[model samples]
Target: MEKKKVLLLGGAGFIGLNITKFLSENRDYTITVADNFSRGKKDEYLIKLLENPAISMIEGDFTVPATYDQLEKDYDYVYMLASVVGVNNTLEIPHEIIRINTALIYNTLEWLKASFVKKVLFTSTSECYAGTIDAFGYKVPTPETIPLTIEDIGHPRFTYAVTKMLGESGFLNYSRKCGFECTIVRYHNVFGPRMGFKHVIPHLAQRFLANETPFLVYGHDQTRSFCYITDAVEGTVLAMENERSNGEIFHIGTMDEITIEELIREAGNFFGYKGEYENAPTYPGSVARRCPDITKAKNMLQFEPKINWKDGLKLTLGWYKAFFESGKESFEKAFEKPKANV
Candidate 1:
């Protein structure tokens, strides 16, 4: 039998690279990783994976329609994981977030109109429903059915979610009309190594490594359910391959919710830091509590998250610790800071 042909639109990023790694390891798919390297180039782990010869790389600015032309017209599976993410960017450059993300979504949908992709997976985020939970007091461990709302539509932070909302509607409707299978997985707080320094875990690792005397735990009481990247990647692959997932939205995350204090204290323990803690204000527009109800994913796709938060957090802390000590600027920060700079 011929090898399965796969396309990953943003495969060089954190979750994308993990998905690519998992797919290439256990299957015989000829995978194409198309990334702008907006975050940065492939890391050592992803580079090592490329040596397997089943994977190939394509670099381009995917926000443009011409970028889609470089991709193969026919793919057995297409994972549309491209987007401008992170709260920093949303807060710093909401306009660019709107421009870039919207362009990427629209360009891809228009391209898919003529492409011969059999099935596609659109990666979404829990940010889509953050306002719903915060403003409406929606139940915790929110399910996929929660209505995505933004408290302030004009606010910069909500711009990211707005574009994601557009992508979700665009991909699902496009698939329905264009005759391609589609599935959506709204990720909760997925964290792991190579996730970049802008995220909470990496920042915490940095502070701990620096031995800050009075650790400032931002949003100390805010709660989230963190999912390990490996488990998230597995669930994503399952959603793409499972026949029952087409036209369905699943929450791919662990249901174990914990507070910021618990997370920080645990990381503090990992770094052997004995320090006082103080609660501090966090990013504006951030939700107070968030988690995913993954029962749909569990029952429909047998998606089970295996790594505990502390266990996964330790692994992530280790990677970020080494990276910071390397005296190297991360790819995302390097590219970001220069853009006036998000």
Candidate 2:
């Protein structure tokens, strides 16, 4: 009767923190959270989690190979969640995204080559198949089998997906050659509190809180299936722990697809804003429609999302509202709307 040891690289971020919280509450494991705090801040949420004696924190730039030295050579489970995320970061620093994300994947793979980690999970995104949908009209509720493509390799936005594609291939192949169990979970639109202000929900919350007279809905018709944080955490853990999931890729999201208009209007209702709504252009290279077919996860791992979109939406909006009402500033730069393309 021994406790399992868990290592969470970049575990201070939104989904990573949620995964840590879930494991700490429900599993009998000693968890180590390693992060550099570049994007994921040591905010109140993370600080509170560290109070649990079972959890420990390591702060270092994981993009550096030397930082991996600080981690133990043996781990019962390793969640490789480190990477540069968010469309804003992709747009602002595409080159840095390529550099840091590639380095993280390479360094971790090399480290695993010599380490004694039993199992590993790499978190990816739906953005990997966005090009297939946009360029070739791939089916909606896309599954893990779709070919990964980039419409414009030169576009800054697609840089994020390119690195994710690398991580997926790198982890799966590395696990086969290096003799470690590996699983991948491509997250759809997972959203919740502490998700940062750069995402759509938080941006909407901020706009409504400001009482904009006419709220603009960027890509009003574009569709996405949003998964709640807890649901995502459950699917991720299931993928990692389930014996059937090794070397398998699962789509960890709900099938509840809705339009951008629905999201914006619902967010407006939460803020009690009676404002005119206008449709506007979205970010460059933004996908027109994206959702994940989670049947593989459901059938193989019995993964199911519990929180519906509206309920999840309300919970997220409420958190953002409280955060703004407290007059607390965003640790990262608040997202600004770009001028609509003519």
Candidate 3:
């Protein structure tokens, strides 16, 4: 049997990397991981994956049109996971976020118009509908049918969400006209090992390691549903492979909602921190609560998340602990203080 040709744009990142591994291990596909190594470096995990004859890597700044020339015209599957994410980047360099994310989405859409790709899965985030929850008080355990709203267009933090909204619209509309299948998956609080330091989990790991006394629980009341990486990858694959998913959007996350205080205390417990805890102001424009309704994904794709938040948290905290204890520094800028949880 011939293997399917699979292309993962920005496949070296946290979720993308795991998706690649999952496919390589379970499915018969010749995988090509295209990335610029901006955030997803040539890490040991990525390097090890590349050692597999079934997997290959392509390095390029995909924002440029010429980079698309490096790819084959025909592929059985294309996972468009490329984007500029993180609340830190949005707050610090909103313009760059717009530039890079817009360019990547637009270029990919144009390329897909002419390519012979069978199906494409565009990864999105729960941040896209955060404004709906904040402004309109949309129901918690939000469903994919909820309207996507931006509270403040001028706010720097919404820049990431804005670009994602563009990708969602662009891919869905383009697939209708361009003759390729497309599905969108909006991830909610997906966390696990190798998810980078800019997120909440890794930051908590770092602060606990520093032995900060009187630990501040930012957004102690804000609630979120954390989905483990493995479960997220499974949901994504099901979305792409399931025929009924075409032209449909799925919320790929868990429904287990917990408070920020609970999350922070869990991390504290993991590190054996016997110290005082205080409530502190979280980053600006952060959501008060977020949890995705996965009924659509469950019904259409039979998606089921097996890892509970507590177990997933332990796995993530353990990875960060080992990484930090090894005296290794992050290749990207260290997020010293807590920013808007992304």
lDDT of each: 0.86, 0.90, 0.93
Worst window of 10 by summed lDDT in candidate 3: 333-342
Q: Write the per-residue lDDT of candidate 3 for residues 1-342, one digit (tens) a residue.
A: 788999999999999999999999999899999999888889999999999999999999999999999999899899999888888888889999999999999999999999999999999999999999999999998999999998899989899999999999999999999999999999998999999888889999989999988998888988999999999999999999999999999999999999999999999999999999999997678889999999999988999999999999999999999999999988778766765365
Residues 269-315 of candidate 1: C-alpha lDDT, one tens digit per residue:
99998879888776556788888999999999999899999899889
Residue 90 CA displacement from its true place in model 1, Å: 0.8
Which stretches of model 1 miss by more than 4 angstroms?
Answer: 334-342
The C-alpha RMSD of each candidate to the native structure, in angstroms, is 2.9, 1.8, 0.9
Poorly placed runs, candidate 2 (over 4 Å): 338-342
lDDT of 3 at 295: 92
Rank by lDDT, descending?
Answer: 3, 2, 1
| Model 3 bad stretches (over 4 Å) | none
Look at candidate 2 and give me any clashing residue pairs: none
Best-first order by TM-score: 3, 2, 1
Clashes by residue pair, model 3 = none
Which candidate ranks first by TM-score, i.e. highest?
3
